[model samples]
Target: MSDAAGDRDTDRGRDRGRGGSAPFAPHEWQIAWRYMRARRREGGISVIVWYALVGIALAVGTLIVVMAVMVGFRAEFTDRILGAEGHARIYPIPVVQDDGRRVSAIDDYDALAERIAAVPGVIRAAPMIEAQVLVSRGSANSGAVVRGMRISDLQDLPYVAHPELSEGSLEDLTHGIALGEGVARELGAYVGDMITMILPGGQATPFGMAPKIKTFELVYVFRVGRADVDRSRVYMTFEAAQDYFNKGDTADQVEALMAHPDLLGSRANPTEADAALIRAAGHNRVLWTWKDANGAFLSALDVERAVMFMILSLVVVIAALNIISGLVMLVKNKGRDIGILRTMGLTQGAVMRIFFLCGAGIGTLGTAIGVGLGILFVIYIDPIFDVVNFLAGGGIWNPEIRMLTEFPAELRWQDVAASAGLALALSYGITLFPARRAARLDPVEALRYE
Candidate 1:
């Protein structure tokens, strides 16, 4: 037994001899890693280590998935909402009546639309009339907003003009009405069907007031992928909308699509120049961007994202506690071995690094697995959501309440890097105490006690 012990010490001496007492020496790594493995008669990596690994992996993955989903939701809502309304809307400066009331209407808007469309960075400018009306098909009736726009302008909107999403041709849009998907479903109306539209106070008669009622074929059924917009909008030609709404040769607004909506009014693009150019074209208008229309909603999403990240970090912090626990256990269990190594000429710093490697290795591996899991979740999110929805009996996503029909996830590398950095920081931080404790152990006392 004494010869065997002597031989083991001689081999350990030779292992450390090549590298001296250098920090992160190859032999130090070898000893650190070997101590983490199990042998038939000796303890190895702790149950606590395994638990810590699993916990860290789960916490990191959950945080990544939540953050990605939040980002995706924000992006989807912004795109759909902006698509439902153009990137910017041009409202005519209201004309003051002689009696002090404001009369708002854009007169000779076609020329103005053409002029606005000619502005740099402006993709398209469309004249439209929007009014509230009640729509009915047989026993079904619902309130809706009728928007009159040219077929060409409607087709210019990518969200509403998809061949897969629409059932009819754009050429027929002027000859008939277009029903949003939600509105069509609510009214049980389909393409080629006639639906009555009643505009209150649309006409004045001897009976004091009369609603202008008309029917037109439902030549188009389309979706903008926004629940509220689809539920509330109906479309017709600019001429029919003007005639029906009694706005003689005028439009309620001119909506413009911009090539870079996010850069609008921002320092990069400075849409003030665009505004100046539009004004130079001889139009008196009040402008509002998509950000103005949905600022509050987007702000709420930002707040939620920040709060969730903070809350989920607690999970990682708690998991990191497990690292401390496992390291403490490991240091305690390896006291005899540590004493033998120290007596064999291993430096205190070397001992510290060995144990640090143990805890940090587990953390590093766990974080890697978590990141891989997060990426896979984002890539296969649709099928995963469908499976979850199926198991939940289709209660996962409701378009009416959530405003979007499907679950979404957008994995950003920045988010992934942030998550990885957080895990590593916490891991390295918690690991130091126990590693230092192991380093400071007195070889004589350790060997004597054991």
Candidate 2:
């Protein structure tokens, strides 16, 4: 009889451990799970919990998508800017001529360029001559920046190579000029067509002033994607530019390429290549970095990114508040159970844990669903946009303004982790007050009301 009684007691303990029948046997988690699975008539989970879950899921998904787009835009703009310009440029301090007029032409630029090229982290250094010229084709005329570059240097640049030649070969570029797509369009010029270039600094003629005019065959038309570059830039051979501009053995600037272009800055934290260029060029010379050229624009992008994040985060906060409301109601509805559990020797901490688990379960499940949805949405974003555009009946993307047909999205794991952590923390934080209230409920009063 004694052995059978002991066996029966052991069986009952095992049942309670597995969350069968017993409400409390030092098994707070079992009670929590029961509470979550309970029906409305049986005092189980409430409808408000589902509402909180949906809210959190949507908020998390929206934040992820928005952040991804913002990152993509920044990356696209940065790449375009870096591709069009060298990492840094070293310009000679304007020299005062006998007439006291300042000229930007750098004398002995080859020796200086060689010195800059030898610097650590410096990939390559090239001397370039830039001049403003009037370009005319037939009746159309426009002001353009004529860049004189060596054939090898031009070929090496990513931006120059990025464009496909609609007509003619790069070899022909040596004998003539290469016009950007925008410039060609504006001037109504085409490959094999002759275009006239007039330099503003003219030679002294019998008359007042005669601008030096030269006609060259346009051998190539290239499109670098950027509208400004395409419209305003014209490329010519280094020697040809020098002769046309009346500048002999001199360049307007020395452009330096760095192994790490992002390190382009004016401060002491500059990369070894930048520091070497500054040291070699001396204080009298002006060194302009890509960052210096686009500081304000980049700063604006950073500010916009931060503002967007803050604004979108409000959605998550609101969703977290819903968790608080749902949990508070759960605590009220489960007061009788809390009283019984406490009377059965469940600690206050255990009571708190049960409610915490309930709220956290909603948060965790919602966040997981949201993250999955966000990833899928980002992956299929292009196709989704195309479908929407098709449904709308016309072109939603403006080719004139947007270079890309589909919106860009870049997903970073750090962003995902941060977002998940924030949501979880908020959910846990909001549950604390209600959980504490449930823990502190007096058994007698709770049972009296029940």
Model 2 stretches with alpha carbons more than 4 Å out: 1-27, 38-46, 164-167, 201-203, 267-273, 388-406
Give the C-alpha miss distance for residue 136 in model 2, angstroms.
Answer: 3.3
Q: Write the per-residue lDDT of candidate 2 for residues 1-450, one digit (tens) a residue.
A: 685465456545655674664443346677778777758574434667887899889988888888888887677767766676678899988878999988887787888889888887778889999988999998999889999988877877776766634556667877899888888989998899999999865666777667889999999888766666777889999999898888888899998888888766765346565666889886668788888877777788789888988887888989988888877877888888888876675656677788888888889988888888888888898888789988999578763475432377889888778778878888888888888888778778899967
lDDT of 1 by residue, 1-450 (tens): 685466456545765785555578788789878877765544444577788999899889988999999999999888787666688777878889999978889887888888878887888888999989999999999999999998888878877777227777657977899888999999999899999999997789998889999988899888777888789989899998988898998899988888878766522234674555357347577777777667778889999999999999999999989998888878888899999998877767778899999889989988988888888888898999889889999876888898887676788889989988999899988888999999888788899956
TM-score of model 1 relative to the true fold? 0.90
Question: Which candidate number has the best TM-score?
Answer: 1
Prediction 2 global C-alpha lDDT: 0.80
True-structure lDDT of candidate 1: 0.83
RMSD of each: 5.2, 6.3
